[model samples]
Target: MRGAHPRVVLGLHRSRYERRPLTAALDLGVRAIDTAFNYHGFTAHQRLAKVAGDLLPRLTLSTKVGYFPGPDGAPQHSLAPSRLLAALEQTNQALGRPPNLVFLHNPEVSLHAPADAAREALSQACEALADASRRGWCESWGIASWDPTPLPDLIDDTTPAPCVLMVRSGLLAGIGTLDAADELTARWRPSAVWGMSPFGGNAEDPVWKTVDPRMFLQEPTAEVSRIQAAFRVAYDLPSVRTVAVGTDNPAHLQEVLQALDRDTDTAMLLKYRKLLRERHAAINGSEARP
Candidate 1:
């Protein structure tokens, strides 16, 4: 798979029931996919296995570990070597092949749990992933989270370096505002940023509905759609190499691809960034710009 910047990867987080759209995306030039071990009741891997035989070699496949529903119907979180290895083997078996990239899903558990306990778990997880990379079960590994608090610790020289970091990011508008993208860029330039939740995880949200692209876009309303406006900001960030945008509808995915291609122009991206920061600052009543 090519490591091209400012490109989009098809996310399989919400496509538990459909696989045809995946092949459709590939036919439409999408070269990467992002999936999680526990997405859709721990069955997403099984579904992907059906198509892995023919298409996996041509795609950059990514999946996550760290959280999955147990037989008792409760979610289990473990970074112990045995458990982590077992999960990896199971996932690889389910997919009929190993993943191109693997991630530690929702590592924010480190931020919420006791410091010492969290570090122990994080350490074990890193060791397990390092072993996976060495054993040929996975090519590369990283962490995926909406929170950035634990990232600095995870990326320290003492730990196993992550080749990719997937996090929640988008235009954000007025909701779920965060300075993580800026912080991440400043501190960790080594890891490629893979952005998730490009449309704030809800494309039809009211916040975006109220936004008028005429205020920022050079061509006013005719140049970009609301969805494109949201994605442009994250894609323009220097550290962000890829943004995962998924849809169950082939037509919608095509539209998203068109938006990415059109809105990523350098001139429009600069204007969009300026306007988004100004709008966010006004909403939060802060003079500081992200």
Candidate 2:
């Protein structure tokens, strides 16, 4: 999962039919691909029915939960663990094979420990996952979150050890530079680190502007140049175990890989990204219709 081909982390929502970008990435030599149980549309679940086994054999399939639509526009985690279990069954049914890893979608609650005495919330999250596994939904499970600090509480006491992973704010952390903290680096090293944002931070980043708005399209915005520069710096020292770049577009992915091939330092990317982001933010802010 760490070595060899370039990893592709795709936020697959809803169907396998919409998997043209993923199918193309498979053709283009992309090895690792990600998805979630909650990404919904039309084709996000088709992989289960069609892509399982044969196509699934050569790739890493990751699915997650903890984020879904509710009646009002509020972030709700009130869905029962039974619902989570149902999602997993659906995922398995769709893929035709077991998912390699299961993660908590951008959980409003910390995948790492929260600042509050939220042990009850944490227990339910893992319990739901375990329940699914007991029911034969996945092969293994892991956590993807904003930071690793809060993760220890969840891991230190699991019945059967659970693998842990980190998810960073694609735009804010850029590339999770802090992944190298001596404490975590020693104990809870991640199997893979989710880059989460190719737009550098919410598709609003400048480097992502060149592509269409397709969820699967991964076009490079002005920030793409900066991000590669950032990778050059981050990858130089080898801070994280693996990097998951979301490639949703065939042409957009080409642009990203070509960009990475051009430059190799993430620090340099960050330097330029600062200026680019500021400019983009100002433009959007000024054009506010209000």
lDDT of each: 0.70, 0.52
* lDDT: worst 10-residue window of model 1: 173-182
Segments in model 1 whose C-alpha atoms lie over 4 Å from true places: 1-6, 153-155, 173-178, 213-218, 237-239, 263-290
lDDT of 2 by residue, 1-290 (tens): 12335544545542343446666767666666676654544235564446444667777777776665557744455325666777677777778777878876544354334534345566677777766666667766766654544444444444233465545533345222333232444465545444454344444365535533222113435554544433323332224444555545666555445444433335544443455446555766843111
149 in model 1: Cα distance from truth in Å?
A: 2.7
Q: Given candidate 1, what's the lDDT at residue 118? A: 67
Q: What's the lDDT for residue 60 in model 1?
A: 87
CA lDDT of 279 in candidate 2? 59
lDDT at 249 for candidate 1?
78
TM-score, cand. 1: 0.82
Using Cα atoms with residue i matched to residue i, what is each candidate's TM-score against the true structure? 0.82, 0.63
- The residue pairs in collision within model 1 are none
